[model samples]
Target: MAKHIIAVGAIYIDTILTLPHFPAEDEKLRASKYVRRRGGNCGNAFEVLQQLVEDDIKLHLISVFPNRASADYAFIRDSFKVSVDLSLSIHRDNSQVASSCYVFKSQETDSRTIVNYTELKDMQCHEFIDAVCKLSPAQDAFEGWFHFEGRTPDTLVECVKELRLIPQYSGFKISVELENPSRVGLELVAAEADAVFFSRAWAEARGFKSAVECLKQNMAATKEHALLCCTWGAAGASAVQKDGGEGIWCSVPAWKPELENQSVVDTVGAGDTFIAGMLCGHCCQTSCWSLEQKLKYATDLAGRKVYEEGFAELS
Candidate 1:
């Protein structure tokens, strides 16, 4: 049987505003439309994974949320059909949970933002214990893979350790993306993962000379683990194996409605969607496609996801 995916990451609710043209200083313009979607950097990845993979390839989204996060969180869990017994982590707090509002522009202009909520910084240890207790009924305690997005290294590593100590586990697989991975965290994760993915445009915006250089730096820092990948939006994606071998390259597949030509409903979750597609292929074991072929599967899904308006309401 195909192994399921156990995704660990964040989740959030996003409010998006689409505008015809961006507003200038002291200029107010009419908005084209507004949308609300289930998202969290971590949550969107799992959503994308479920849409791209098989029904048997289960997803476990390990994440944090505030006390009042039940409604939004439940919707995503039921929609994705993931086994959340072991992956969902709840943090109780008196404060309001974090949410992001994006103002998307049609032309070349900046969109203003209003909603500002604090990120989850603290989570109770007891919740982690409770989450593990729920995993007792799963078919395989570790039959799935691990995925982490924006999860703190210290906290996640502790969870990793705890899971490793469990005697009932079968096999565990993992792929991770660091929304804000520190040098130390990245080094630790890269060394332990089956595959690691990076977005070139996002990296470039943050001022890394080139994606290749960044991967090389990361690989050099990592002593173990092979299969490091870099996803270039329209350009495509590439992966580098360990032993300092030559790299493999693949073009990002074109979507049904070209993302460039199609109306970009919202771009926030596109990257997360891309990662979900890539991870799905790995988890399925049904994909005989080469590395590039596997990655294109993901890129195509991400392109389709953005054209649609929200966190892919996959049919």
Candidate 2:
């Protein structure tokens, strides 16, 4: 039987403008260049995962969008280079798609400032459960994996709980990313996941100084067999897995460009790319790799992503 991976989150139309520096208050500046693409935490991950996965494993996305007639919806649907199943997505009538505007400073360190606008309603727990049931009608159909972008905490927690009650989805593995620190109730979602990805900002906001410390202290909140991973930007990434009643921790240094003077060109979607790499290693790869190998693969892939503008040819 073929396998399926479903990613749940919002989709956005991203307008990126490159400039030498941010403009002063009330000052006008001309952008050096601009690019537009389909972007969102889940959208970006699906793009990279489609490139990494094998032919047999299928990819699906469960997101809420405007009506099919909207140009924004059409652009997002036609943007993917690889085939991704968007049939599971929900459409809203008379609604507009979410959008984000980014001002990227092309200088040392390459800083980015983003502003987002959205009026669409979030996906409710019932909607998520309905999509899952449609995808998995039979108990022995195929192995399934569900990855979530941690938004709408109340509905997300309920969604996971509801999924657990379904007999056909008992074998499915769940992973979630906690990237935004301001989003409350994410710990509840993390507790239900088989794997949890933590961002540097999320850790620091919770008073954890290092990635290792963040994983070690939070291990109690998760399941005994859960895998906890944290990414620390330039400090690299770390992971801790429970083994025979003990937690084993592994850390890897940040990957650098092979060619000298190859600095970071774009930082957008790097974290999402890392999530794709880890999922690829655990879900698509045939060999059983160690925790260290998984971290290294994800870290290297995220590092390579910074050298390019968009998520093309990353694999």
Candidate 3:
């Protein structure tokens, strides 16, 4: 049998209010649209993973899904066929969860705001592993890559440590630490993973501009295998393999010749989509692929996914 992929990250409710123009400070300007998109790094991973693995693999998403309110916060749990082990991640507070508010009309141009509406409480990752351990490994239930959207919160780190202790099996047990906003960054987690993926936005945010710089810094610092990457806008992606191979760049040009009609609704989750493609390539044992190949396919899928309004919309 094949190993499974585990996606872990924060899940939240997104309140998106689009205005024809950027809102002025304290000025009431509501001339546009309003909508809600699932706004969690963990949530975004599910959108990408399910689209790629729902029909073929036994994917599991570990997150906090509070049933305190009548709202169906756990919508994806039922919508997608994957097992959503919510015991560890779901916050029990009835109060509304905090969210990221985005205002944008262009891919590179836009502003986002984060507001903490409720006291953030999440499950201890040990709690998460304990839940998974309940499932019989003899039944071949829990084993595979554990991909985390971001790294923070001591609980999750504990969870990662425990997962590493599981008896050696055919599973990869990996974690995707998408550049986290936390001060502790992925460097700590890098040494613990079989693979670490980085996107241009996250890479730049970390003050490492190019993929080469990112790779050099992380590879030197982390002993665990790491694949430093930068998702170039329209140009595609640049990736450095963990085996100390030379860095490679791939081009994923715009979908159409016309930029105005590119159908780009939002670039919010493109990075996550790209990760999905790369994960697919790795999980499926794609042979000796040029780095450009991964970039092209990842960009194509991510670019297309943005045309939809939210993190993901099935066509």
Every model's Cα RMSD, please? 4.1, 1.5, 3.6
Please list all clashing residue pairs in model 2, or write none if there are none: none
lDDT of 2 by residue, 18-92 (tens): 887777799888888889889999999989999888878889999998988888889999987556999888888
The TM-score, computed over Cα atoms with residue i paired to residue i, of candidate 1 is 0.77
- Candidate 3 residue-wise lDDT, 1-315, digit = tens: 545666776666666665566656897765466666666666676677676654445566666665545354544344444354443344556644443444344223454444534345566766677656654354554445667766463555566677767664335657565555454645666666666776666777878766657666776664444565666566556666666554433444634434575555666767777777777666654576666676566667777777777655532
lDDT over C-alpha atoms for residue 247 of model 1? 49
Q: Each model's C-alpha lDDT?
A: 0.60, 0.88, 0.60
The weakest ten consecutive residues by lDDT in model 3 span 99-108
Query: Would you give me the overall lDDT of model 1?
Result: 0.60
Which scores better on TM-score, 1 or 2? Answer: 2
lDDT of candidate 3 at residue 185, scale 0 to 100 = 47
Candidate 1: list runs displaced more than 4 Å.
21-29, 68-87, 91-106, 109-116, 119-121, 124-130, 136-141, 167-170, 180-185, 205-209, 243-263, 311-315
lDDT of 3 at 45: 60
Model 2 error, position 137 (Å) = 1.2
* lDDT value, residue 166 of candidate 2: 89
